[model samples]
Target: MPGIRKSLLQLVFSGTSMRRWNDKMRPMELMEVDKQAHKMIMAWMLYMLNGSDLDRKDFIDLGDKIVLGGMYDYLYRLVITDIKPPVFYQIKANPAHYQQLTQWVLEQLKPRLQSLGDPFWKGMREYYADGASRDDLASRILDAAHLLASQWEFHLIKDLNPKDEEMDEIEANFIQGIEGFQDLIGVRELMQGNKASLGRFAQLCGQLRFQQRWSQTPRIPETAVLGHMFIVACYGYFFTLMVGGCKARRVNNFFAGLFHDVPELLTRDIISPVKSSVKRIGDLIKEYEFKELDSKIFRTLEQGGYFELSRRLKYFLGVDVGSEFASTICLEGDTREVEWDQLQTIYNNDDCDPKDGFMLKICDDLAAFIEAYTATRNGITNDQLQQALWKIRKKYQQVSLTETMHIGGLLADFD
Candidate 1:
């Protein structure tokens, strides 16, 4: 059984410090992690749109590939941080040079990744060991997502970089690459939307990159709400796998993590202290979030013939159930909330389309803990960071995610 470890968690979060578009002038520092978060969101959207066209067998494993692919790209970027994209592509064209560089990356990753077990490690090796690109549906969708997300970021800074000599060339390349994926079902739908519903939804998610977490506190590498959601989603999936969740349960949990904070995009990230400062204030905030989400997002999609997308979002966000953190399963064509213990004993089957709300909450807390812990370790010590670390540790001291996984014990490794 796989388990979450400090090193692996830290390894994924390392992208927080990896800067993007460093050579160009920008309004805010665009971090690699935020870009990656946005990319995976788009990739998942594309996957949803075109997933049925592929083999049924692909459904079980496609989500894993998308998640792992994003991580693989992130790990590669961390090692080759100084290499420009154009220069890196040129190097990639040379098989010998790319292979050598890949081997070095494997060597670097081995120590941090060994804890994930041989199967996962071997898969990563096989993916990049030869320095070749995958051409399957999942790979194509991921590539398309990467291109579009990068183009989105480019648009943000395009006007600001008017004086940069490479700006025009870069913009042209982005447009060409994005248009190249027009054959994809999701990409084509996004591009051809009469109301631009899909495009608008994607843009809304990208904007989360501007909303920083812990807005009032300073940290070594400040993280955005967008990247934080991706981290939680990845952790939710990994933890689900660790405990032997079925494929549907795993997918449900991952998406639950990914969009858990979508309401925040409308309401903004209100700190916990403020939310709970007044009784029922949190409830009021949640009520407003649901209203805005229905009007601004869900209705737009439904009107644009994206009824399935809107329905899935509602299920993931628990619109009918009242809380995303409530364990639920579809029984006899009706969604029903189940207690954690009852869910484990009864509805933990693929056909039920079960989602582990308790598990997602744990993943969210873990992500937040790591954020606070990392900031303190990076020498940005202060009351807010220190207090956050302490409280999170205390909260999880006795919580066990699985028989082999104790949240507190895993966190203690940081000390």
Candidate 2:
């Protein structure tokens, strides 16, 4: 069985420091992690758009591919560390040099990644060892999402740095690369000329990058809601794997983690104290979130004939289930709440479409704890940050998410 380790979790968080577009002037520093968050979210949208053409088995395979591809790309970026795109592609143009560099990257990753078990390590090694290419539909979707996300970042600084000579070439490359994936579902709609409703939804989701978490607190390398969502999703996926979750459970948990905070994009990040300060303030917030979600997001998608997307988003948000943290399973065309034990023993299979909501909540809390811990470690010793670190550690000190994964011991590593 797989087990979560400090090295694995720390490896995922390391992307927080890997800056992007560092060669250009910009409004704000764009990090590699944020771009990854945007890319995966867009990839999920593309995956859903193409669902009609895929079967259940295909769904499982494609979802795993998108996530693994994202992880591999992140690791590669960490190894390359801000190499200019042109120069990097030139390295790729030389097959021998590229293979040599890939070997080095694999060597760098093995110590940090091998703990996840042989299956994951073998798959990752074979992917690069065999030459990573965009041959499948999932690869096309992920590559298109990556291009579109990078283009979105470029648009942020385009007007400010108008005199940069390479800007036009960069923009043209983005267009050309994205165009190559237009044959895939959802790619054409996101292109420059299209006015798809899904495009608008993507833009709305992208705006979360500007909404910083812990909005009032000062911290080194502040994180945004967008990147935080992605981190939690990653934790959820890994934890599911560790706990022996089925394919559908793994995918559902990942996506549920990814969209858990979608309503925050509309309502903005409300700290827990404010939400619970008044008796029914939390309830009122939920009511408002649903209303805004229906009006601004769901209605538009449904009107545009993307009913399935809207339905899935609603399911992810736990609209009918009352809370996103409630464990759930689909049975006989209806979603029903189930106890975690029942889910593990009975419905832990593809046909049931199980989602480990409680586990997702643990992942969410773990992500938040890590965020606080990282900021504190970076020399930001403010009271808010310190208190956050203390609170989460105290809460999970005796908690264990699985038989082999002890939360208290994991938290102790930061001490």
Model 2, 1-415: lDDT tens digits are 4578778887787787888888899899788878888898899988888766788789888888888887788778888886788998998878888889899889998887887778878988877875645477777888889999999999999988889999999998988888788887777766542277888888888888888999998877788888888888888888888778888888888888888998997899999889999999999999999999999999978877889889888888888788888898887768888988877879999899898788888888888888888888888888888888888888888887667888888888887
Cα lDDT, all candidates: 0.84, 0.84
Q: How close is candidate 1 to the true structure, as a TM-score?
A: 0.94
Model 2 misplaced regions, further than 4 Å: 192-194
Which residue window of length 10 is worst by lDDT in model 1?
186-195
What is candidate 1's lDDT per residue for 1-415, written digit by digit as tens?
4678898888878888888999888999999888988898888788778875555457647866777777678777778888999999888989899998889888988887777777668888888866765787778888899988888888889999788899989988877887878888778655443448898888888899999999999987899999998888878877777777777787888888888999988999999999999999989988998999999999988877888788888888888898888888976557888887665667777778888888898888888888988888888899988888889889999998668989999989989
RMSD of each: 2.1, 1.5
* Model 1 pairs whose backbones collide: none
Clashes of 1: 0
List candidate 1 stretches off by more than 4 Å: 53-57, 189-195, 331-333, 342-346
